[model samples]
Target: MEQLRVTNQDREHVVEHVKAAYAEGRFDELEFEDRLERAMTARTHGDLMPIMSELYGPRGVPMPRPVPPRATPARMHTGPTESPERLAASAAHGLAAIGFPIVGPLIFLLTGGKTSPYIRQHALEALNFHLTVIGASILLPITVVGVVLLPVIWVAAFVLSIAGAVSALTEGSFRYPMTLRLVK
Candidate 1:
C-alpha cells in the first residue's frame, strides 16, 4: 500500500471529498473506511490533491479555486458600538484601576477589536505597565504598613489583570471608570 503524502491544503480537500462522497451513498462501508484512512494519512498538497482528484474524477467533480489570503487592516476604528470582548476587557481594566491605578484604564481605552497592529502594541504596553506596577509593589517596600498593604492590592490587581487579558483574547471591548483618559 502506497502512503499518501498530503499538504495541509490537500488534506482539507480530501476530507471534503470523503464527506461529500459518503453523503451521496457512493461507497459501501468497507470502501468508505479505506478511503477515509487514506485521506487521514495524506500530508502534503502533492500527496492528497492527486489522491482526491483520482477518487472524485469518476463523478466529474470540479476542482475548487484557491482562496486568496486576507490583507491586514491599516488602522483601528471604533464607532458608537463596541464588541463584547472589548467591553469585558474595559470593565476588567476599570475594576483593576480601583487598586492598581492608571494602567488598567489605559489598556481599556487603547485596545479594541479593530485589526490594527498599533492598537495591539499599545494594549500590550499597558498590560506590561500594570504588571510592572503590581510587581514593584510586591517586591519593594521600606515601611511595614506599605508591605501589608501591597499584598491586598496585589490580589485585586491579579484578578483584574487575568480578566482583562481574557477579555482582550476574546476580542471584546472593556471600559474602566475614573482613570486618566488617554484615548477617546
Candidate 2:
C-alpha cells in the first residue's frame, strides 16, 4: 500500500487540536509545545495520527483502510449463432415484459440451458434481470422516493426487455444494464 501524504490543512488541524487540548488542561505547557512542534513537522498521516492518538486515544483519528476494487462478471458469447437458438433466446427476453418475468426465462433455462450454452447465457441474463425487477418492484414501493420511481423502473424494464429480444435476434447476445445477475 502507498503511504498517504499529509497536507498543510492536516497539520493545521492537528495543531488546532493540540491547542484545544492544552486549553482544556489535558496537558502541561511543555507537553503542549512538544505536540505543537510535532504537528507542524508531520509529513504523513502516520506521523500526525500518533499525536492525535496520544491526545484523544486510538478511536479519535481513524486510519482509512485501502479498499479492494470490485469485479463484475462478463457473460458474452462470440460463437456462431443458430436460428433456433436465436429464437429461443429472443423469447426468453421478450416473455419477461409479457408478465412472465420469472417463469418464462426459468422454463427456457431448465429446458435448453444444459444443451445450448448460448441459450443458457441468454436465459440466465433474462432470469437475473427479471428477478432484479421483481425485487425492485417489491422493495421500491416501501419508500416515498421509491414509489415515485417504481413506474419509471417498470417502463425501463419493458423497453429494455424489447431491446434485449431485438438484440438477441440480430446479434445473438445482449446484457441488461443495472442487472444484479444473481442467477449466475
Summing lDDT over every window of 10 consecutive residues in candidate 1, give the lowest-scoring window.
175-184
List candidate 1 stretches off by more than 4 Å.
1-76, 79-115, 118-122, 125-128, 131-140, 175-184
Question: TM per model?
Answer: 0.30, 0.57
Best by TM-score: 2
lDDT of 1 at 20: 80
RMSD of each: 12.9, 16.3
Write model 1 residue lDDT over 83-157, tens digit each, in one string: 654554445454455664554545444655245433443354445546566556766687788788777766755
Q: Give a tens-digit lDDT track for model 2, residues 1-184.
A: 1158988999999999889878876778999999999989888888888898987779865434335346433334563357888888888998997989999899999997878887788889999999999999999999999999999999999999999888878855689999998987
Give lDDT per model, in order. Answer: 0.54, 0.85
What TM-score quantifies how close candidate 1 is to the native fold?
A: 0.30
Error of 2 at 104 (Å): 0.6
TM-score between model 2 and native: 0.57
Ten contiguous residues minimizing lDDT sum, candidate 2: 65-74
